[model samples]
Target: MSSEHFDVVVVGAGLSGIGAGYHLQTLCPDRSYVILEGRAQLGGTWDLFRYPGIRSDSDMYTLGYSFKPWTQAKAIADGPAILDYVTQTARENGIDRHIRYRQHVKSAAWSTDEARWTVQAEGPDGPVSYTCSFLFMCSGYYNYAAGHTPEFAGAADFGGRIVHPQHWPSDLDYAGKRVVVIGSGATAVTLVPELAKSAAHVTMLQRSPTYVVSRPSEDRFANWLRAKLPAKAAYGITRWKNVLFSMFFFNLARRKPEKVKERLLAMVRVHLGPDYDVGTHFTPRYNPWDQRLCLVPDADLFDALKSGAAEVVTDRIAHFTPGGILLEGGRELAADVVVTATGLELQLLSDVAFEVDGVPVDLASTYNYKGMMYSGVPNLAHSFGYTNASWTLKADLTCFYVCRLLNTLQKRGLRQTTPRIGAEALKPQPFLDFTSGYVTRAMEKFPKQGHRWPWKLYQNYAQDLVTLKYGSVDIEMEFSNPVPTHAQKRATADA
Candidate 1:
């Protein structure tokens, strides 16, 4: 098949991809681009997961793109609502036309001689190829095909329906049934309150505790700002407000973990009441910010607990009985349905194979540059968001920087830009410092970060804003023009 050529190729049509497309069009208007989406539809994460009570853990102000305003009433929105927002953005901006759905990129090979990337993808028809001057990977960090579901001793013995949040069955009925959700992370927390509404009873079973915080469902301040000011201005002000608040809390958590732990537990205690055993369920052994804090809007989980519709069981599972899970102490909890909201399976670069000049790129050996690009990768950028703040906050900055880099390349007549590690004896650290199960499981599969500037992945959005937006690009980056091809040289000589 003939290869379709473009100036840029963006993988994934989700939040980051749409944002990247917008910036590329606005900042580098002369360049042509295409968005390759693996799924038939848009909204990557929001469209994939169909579990009950699926919503954003972070607020919408910062989660929404910098150029767009999230005017919805609820800051923490549901899956359908978030998906609609993303779809509307693409439609309204005319970005939907550039999207090629069901195009799953299998591999990308970079040619230094041509200063281009030849990407191979499997589309609905068959094998397809595309060449582009720059590649942008916006595919998220998690695997869409499956979630992290550990094998229980007798999972097959249970007659009840077992479901993983990643691949939730659309027709599976859980209404008026006793549902047991395993795990205590965001998914588990989200499903418990939602399932409790109609289920006869919902129980969250966790081996250990996670720090959970209660936040308001609606942002009164943001609403007020939208009411008084222009849409763009209101969005800007609310975005900054959220950024500052998130940064302050994250800094406080790291600086004074004990104090932050106390404050978080106190909030939980207030929501659950003094009679509730907050220590056993809400208190975590590790310090605050070691893992992400689960956000429960309006204390919905606590409200369910108070209403006797849900309960928390903290204990190790011995095995699965015919009717329910058997705890270590031989106590059996009745369960008509089991929801494994264990965690996500992290897959970087969409697990797409990469090669540079016939040499395979070993992602593990390289270091991350500015948390977006790899040390040895040229003319490529990946969208990885802040673990602490809303994803779009970092995504916006990364896309903006990529646009700037593309414009610089065009103006300078350069064909390639790659980050080369310096001679400094820098200590290498894991890319992400979180202790979450999903992150820990996939830590070795990703690249490491240096202890110093430029190579380090700072989780701080404020620091990233100054560095990515205003920082010098030539600090560790190398730019060059590829040697002219034979045809080009012959044409020049003939002219």
Candidate 2:
């Protein structure tokens, strides 16, 4: 069988992939590319999640693409709205046509002799193959098929339905029924208020308190700017404004943890009133931004609690009883339904098997290069976002950097370029400095960062912007290994 070839092959047709397509179209229009998506739909996260009140934890101005303007009123938009935005982007830019749906990428092999990567995927019919000069992996950081669900003793004993938010049932009705939502992450916080709207009472059962902050769904400043200026102009200003503010707050949180923690708890008190036990249900042991802070739009979660529609329960589950979950201290929270909003299952390169010149490549053993490319990985890039800020911020920068690299390769007439590092040049560090359970559980499987520049992950968007956008690509990068014409011919014949 003959394999289709292109200048670039992008894995995953999610937010990152669509942005990459746009960048390639505008920046490198001469290059041909294709997007291979595992799922039937285009939007990855937005399309996959369909639980009640599903929305973005980050504001849309920053979560949205750098090239596109978020014209919606709500800065913290819902799932459908965000999906429409992503779909609209692809449709408008003609990126949708380039996407091959239901193509689950299985493996990729890089050939140094031919200066290309042969990608294999499990298509609907059977196995499919393609080759590309450059490979871009944008398939987010988590497993789409499953979430991190801990085993609960006697879970089978529960009479009512138990569902994980990752796979929420469509027809399962909970109207006027008691509901217990497990976990205090963004999903749990978002679900409680929305579930409380219909459920008789919603109980948020969390193992530990997570820092929660509330803001309006719509941004007044952003709205005012939109009214006064053009779409792109207003979006640019609002995006920067949010970026700078978040950086400042994150820096403050790190510098003065106690002060920031107290201030955050104080805000929770103002929302829950003086009688509420802020320390028990709201105060977190960790500093702010150590893990991501959960965001509630317009203090919805607090309002639900105050109105007696919902309540926060801080305890460990002893077991799942017939009526509901039984706590460790003999307290039983009776519920008709249970929703596990447990965290995600993290993965590297979407768990795709990679081989470099017939040798298996273990990503965890390699060092990260500017948080995009791995050390000694030739002509490949991965799009990973920030922990403290919006994901698209780093994604946008990564796309720009990849395009720049492709242009450089073409200009210099080079076939392959890899990040070259001396054996003792730098000390190894954790790729992400985050302490979240999802991150910690899968940290060992990820690539390591280094103590110095180009190998370090700053996580700060401003620093990344400077390095990826305007920084030199020649630093520690070996640009050689141009394939001979006859060598390419021989490789083609063998394939």
Candidate 3:
């Protein structure tokens, strides 16, 4: 296969990837880049997940790109709207023209001698190859092919249709039929209320509970600001306002877990009434923010629960019976359809194999540098978002920093930049502090973090903004393999 070379090769044409393209073009205009997308279209997560009630758990203000203003009225937008926003950003900025679809990246091998990466991918016709001075991995952190679904005992006995939210069948009609959604996370919460609209009765079954919060779909402050100020100015102010509030709330939750928990449960009690079992169904065993708190726009989930359209059942599953699921407490949830809103199957760097100078690199053994680049990895960075806040916040900061790093390298005439944890005896910590099943199950396979700055992941947007956008780039990073100019090469040859 022919190998085309570019200054940068961005993996995945998702929110992060498109943002990366925009930053590269604006900040480093001289650099050439291409976005390799595995799917036929863009909008990675938004396009792939077609499940009912698919909406963003985070508000749009902070979730939106820093460069773009989210003019939509809804702060908690549905999937299609978010997809439109992402694709629109690409099209308006001409980023979509650089995208190559149906390119599934398989492996990337970096050669120190060449000071570049050789990327191998499978295309529609055959294998394709590309060489890039920098490889930006915005492919996200989950497996695209499948979501995590535990092997249910006697699953074969279930005569009804059982579907995972990741792969929802479009033609399957659940109208007026009993639907059982398994799990209490964001997906289950979202699906329960939406499915309850037409389903006979929808039940959300969970072994434990998750912290859920309610907020209005529209932001009154944002609307008022937009009516007074310019769109960009209003958006910027609103974005910062939300960011500060998120930081304050997160800090408060961490410091005063009991107080936060009490308030959260109190809110739920108001929605469900005092007669409901708040302790068993609405309360989580862990502290708030321990796992991500689910967001229900306009209290839709609560309204469904209060109206008897949907119900939450907390119990372990015994097995899948012929008609529905059998609980451990001898409770059987009879249903015509079973939807597994089970957690995602997390993967590292889009499951792409990597090697440095022909030596295989295991990411699990490396240390994460600034939550973007891994230890000992050269000319490559991954866009990983925050677990506690909006993903695009961190992703935007990462893109900005990558552009800065690339520009710095160009000015210095350097070809390779690798983070080395040399002589630093630092203890390893879990990649993420989340206790969610999806994170815990796959944490061991990902890179670890250190105890110090640059190695430690703060997960704070403000701190990341200051560090990534303005901090020193020479810390723990080894810049080598200088590219000699023609004058230097001629002088050396004469000598």
Q: Model 2, residue 342: what's the lDDT? A: 85
Over 4 Å off, model 1: 485-495
TM-score, per-candidate, Cα-based: 0.98, 0.98, 0.97
What does candidate 3's lDDT look like per residue over 398-433, in tens digits?
A: 999999899889899888999988676879999999
Candidate 1 per-residue C-alpha lDDT over 141-220 given as tens digits, one digit per residue, 9 for 90 to 100 = 98888888998998889989899999999998999999999999999999999999999999999999999999998999
Cα-lDDT of candidate 1: 0.93
Expressed as tens digits, the lDDT of each residue in 211-246 for candidate 2 is 999999999999999999999999999999999999
Task: Quote the lDDT for 106 in model 1.
Answer: 97
Q: In candidate 1, where is summed lDDT lowest over 10 consecutive residues?
A: 419-428
User: In candidate 1, how many Å is residue 438 off?
Assistant: 0.6
Question: How many pairs of residues collide in each model?
Answer: 0, 0, 0
- Candidate 1, clashing residue pairs? none
lDDT (C-alpha, whole model) for all candidates: 0.93, 0.94, 0.94
